[model samples]
Target: MVASRSQVADVAANAFRRSCLMARISTKEELRRIIAEPRPATRVKILDSLDEQSIEFLKRCPFALVGTTSADGTVEVSPKGDEPGFIRVEDPKTLLIPERVGNNLAFGLNNILDTGEIGIIALVPATGETLRISGTAEIHDDPELVASLSSLGKPALLATRVRIKHCYFHCARSIVRAKLWDPKAWPAPGRISFGKIIAPRIGESEAVAAQIDANVEGAYTTRLWQNT
Candidate 1:
């Protein structure tokens, strides 16, 4: 006899669960054993400071992601962007990020305050290579430093200083695989209702989404670019 839809669904779900369980590589030792170490060229790419090559790469990059973790081990990532050369290579070992106005949640900033550890992944458009920087961070609110990195007549409220511990030029394999800069490979953009996702966490889930959506539209049209 043919299986009913409910029976078929049950069988499919069980198979998926089994596949997921079997596919997980359970431990770091297991992962290390399966993957070979980096080749000499790859190994040599890691450096202690911003070399001339790395400095040039960063000067050309307009965007980067900041990764940080709180003392409690909560992790957060925030995106930073501006015109090319927005990030200043203050010295061979230090880099500065101008803290512009954002959502004001300050998740990334608070993490830096709590733990002082930070990571950076800087990317340039149309270039498959990326720069990765791992460092200890401190927040600087000095007027001179903030004014030095101003954008559009508004100085940054603060600046984030990263004293590099290790930095590297990451190869292009990941970017090439993702086809990140190829417009032809991109999916059509869609509107996202972020409010719908958060509504259930706060109060009555029904009206919250609409209220948040309206607030978002208002901000986007009026207040979004006011600070920057």
Candidate 2:
């Protein structure tokens, strides 16, 4: 007797589940078996400090993702952006990121205080390549240093200084694959309703959510450079 359509569907679903379970490699050896090793040149490309090329790259980079970890090993990543070259390369071995107006949660900042380690991936708009740097970091509030990192005629309240330990240019394959700079291939933008997210969790009404969203948008426009 021929299998019914439902039986056939059930068989296929079970096969997919089995394949997924079998595809997971739990050991490094199993992982290495399927993935090729990096080329020797790739292995040696990490640098201890920023080179001339790296410094020039920073001159055009306006955005970066900063990564930090807390004492309990929780990780936090924060996005920072400003005019090109907003991040100052204090020297070949050091760099600084000024703190700007933001929500006071301070998860990433507090993580930096708990664990001095930091990693950053700096990117330039419309460019596929990115620069990756990992190093030790310290939060600084020196008046002169903070003033030097200012933007829009307003000095930064604090700066995170990184002592570079490893620096490298990441290949552009990931960006190319994601089509990040290709506006033609982009999907429609989606709205982020912070009020909808927060209000429901707190058992608040739609009116409260609307008020929260209005406050968020107001802050975005008025408080970017300084607190309103």
Candidate 3:
């Protein structure tokens, strides 16, 4: 006998619950029992504001991962990239990230508006170490600042200014282990199909999905610095 759709969903939900409940660590003591403690220097390395080394690091960073959380507890990590120095160092304690054109979801932007909290991991290409920063953030639409962040001659719609609270250089163990900077260790590239993923949910046909795929590819070239 075949199971109903609801019945199959119930079975899957039960399995997920069981997996979540298995071997869960509920407290710090339980967590510490398994993972080793950080070294003394690790605790002291976090700075309240950017130091000279960190400021220099930011100057060469062309990419960063911006993390934010909404009031409803949803977390969003958006990748932002541009030419080196896309992010401006307003001062030792503040950073300006230019908002670029992309999918209009605005998940990260909305989260900053709701919570004012943000985290960022600045990365430079061909390097393993990453700079991690956490702080309060605010969305700004100041005309002069936005214009300064323009890329390809198109001005940014807005910017996120972060006030530094904690800043540190994260170790490169993860990157080194993954050989992230080594082209020789890279795996074959994979393709993502937004059409295939969204078609069923939106009640669309394969033709619509194909159009979506084509539009998405077209946007990569036409919409990088401007709206389509």
Clashes of each: 0, 0, 0
Write candidate 3's Cα lDDT for 1-228 as tens digits.
999999999999999999888878998998999987998988999999999989999999999999999999999999999999888999999999999888889999999999998999999988788999999999999999899989878899999999999999998999999999999999999879999998878999999999888988888876566567
Scored by CA lDDT, what does every candidate get? 0.90, 0.92, 0.92
RMSD of each: 4.0, 3.4, 4.3
Task: List candidate 1 stretches off by more than 4 Å.
Answer: 1-29, 198-211, 226-228
**Model 3: residues with Cα > 4 Å off, grouped in runs:** 1-22
Task: Give the Å shift of residue 106 in candidate 2.
Answer: 0.9
Return whichever of 2 and 3 wins on TM-score: 3
TM-score quality measure for candidate 2: 0.88
Model 2 ranges with Cα > 4 A deviation: 1-23
- Candidate 3 — which pairs collide? none
Give the Å error, residue 144, model 2: 1.3
Model 2 C-alpha lDDT per residue in residues 1-228, reported as the tens digit of each score: 999999999999999999999998999999889897889999898899999999999999999999999999998999999889988999999999999888878999999999898999999988888999999999999999899988889888899999999999999999999999999979999778999999999999999999989988888787566554
Local accuracy of candidate 1 as per-residue lDDT tens digits, 1-228: 999999999999999999999989998877888897768987887899999999999889899999999999999999999879888999989999998877889999999999999999999999998999999999999999999998878888899999999999888899889999999989999778868877977864668898888877777777655542
Which 10 consecutive positions of candidate 2 have the poorest summed lDDT?
219-228
**For model 3, what is the alpha-carbon lDDT of residue 201?**
85
lDDT of 2: 0.92
